[model samples]
Target: MPRPHGFSYEIRNDTSVHITHQGRAAATLRAGRAAAFLAEVENGDAQLVMARWTGSYKFGNERTARNHPRNRR
Candidate 1:
């Protein structure tokens, strides 16, 4: 749950868009001003991509943490 590596994403401010390494949102893209910026992207394309990427990372991270040697029960 500690996302120590953090996520990666490319932001195209000129186009008001971004893309993750997996072709989704590279970071959390939190709600608020940042969300507002993502809203400007075409078809919310960048937003959708980021959402998927973040979700996937979080899920995978949680699964791995749950099975980690230190976390084992």
Candidate 2:
């Protein structure tokens, strides 16, 4: 699968995390979630981490599902 891109995050002064994808707001994490996300992001791919946090990460089955016999239009 291709690596996820276009994901960025900002830490607000109030300790909230604002996550964006392709320049649009995708998720806002506050308090406990924000703390956890910061910890994980520091240890892994930031883009992938953001994508996963926003529930937007691909699971590697998209192409197969798209071309499956039953999916043909």
Candidate 3:
């Protein structure tokens, strides 16, 4: 199945996790690793960031993250 927009951590029946970003699959990690990553995120070992865009995709802007709006909060 296609991925969902934004961030999501989905656990599969086999105990593997599917990580998605911007409607795309970014990574697939084992359940153990996934848990560790989540722990890191919670402990501040990782920084989670997101960006959004406007102009209805008509701006023809690049998909590069450097141009996306950073999360200010």
Candidate 4:
């Protein structure tokens, strides 16, 4: 069997690509990095939220990608 609905890429302006799966935020890729994200997704090297700490992908509407896995203050 295969995934019913896999990743979906939405180009937000000229330098961004927002990736979504089943309506979740998933990942937001910037510039040419979109291709790299796609390649990862394609090659099964990463999942929707795989780049959990990558500055390259801005996840969620609140831009929580950077602060994720928050460090103790």
Best by TM-score: 2
Model 4 lDDT, residue 57, Cα:
42
- Top candidate when judged by lDDT against the true structure: 2
Which segments of candidate 4 are over 4 A away from where they belong?
1-4, 35-73
- Residues 49-70 of candidate 2 have per-residue lDDT tens digits of 9999999888899999999999
lDDT of 3 by residue, 29-56 (tens): 7767767665655665221411111111
In model 3, what are the clashing residue pairs, if there are any?
A: none
For model 4, name the residue pairs that clash.
none
All candidates: TM-score: 0.27, 0.89, 0.44, 0.40
Which has the better lDDT: candidate 2, or candidate 4?
A: 2
Where in model 3 is the C-alpha error above 4 Å?
Answer: 1-5, 41-73
Model 2: how far is 48 from its true place, Å?
A: 1.5
Per-residue CA lDDT of model 1 for 6-63, tens digit only, reads 3345545453334455444444444464556555544555434455545543444677
Q: Across residues 1-73, which tens digit of lDDT does each residue of candidate 4 receive?
A: 1222444566676767776665777667786677666566666744433443232343244435446667324
Cα shift from native, residue 31, model 2 (Å): 0.3
- lDDT computed for candidate 1: 0.49
Locate the minimum summed-lDDT window of 10 residues in model 4. 52-61
Q: If both were scored by TM-score, which would come out higher, candidate 2 or candidate 4?
A: 2
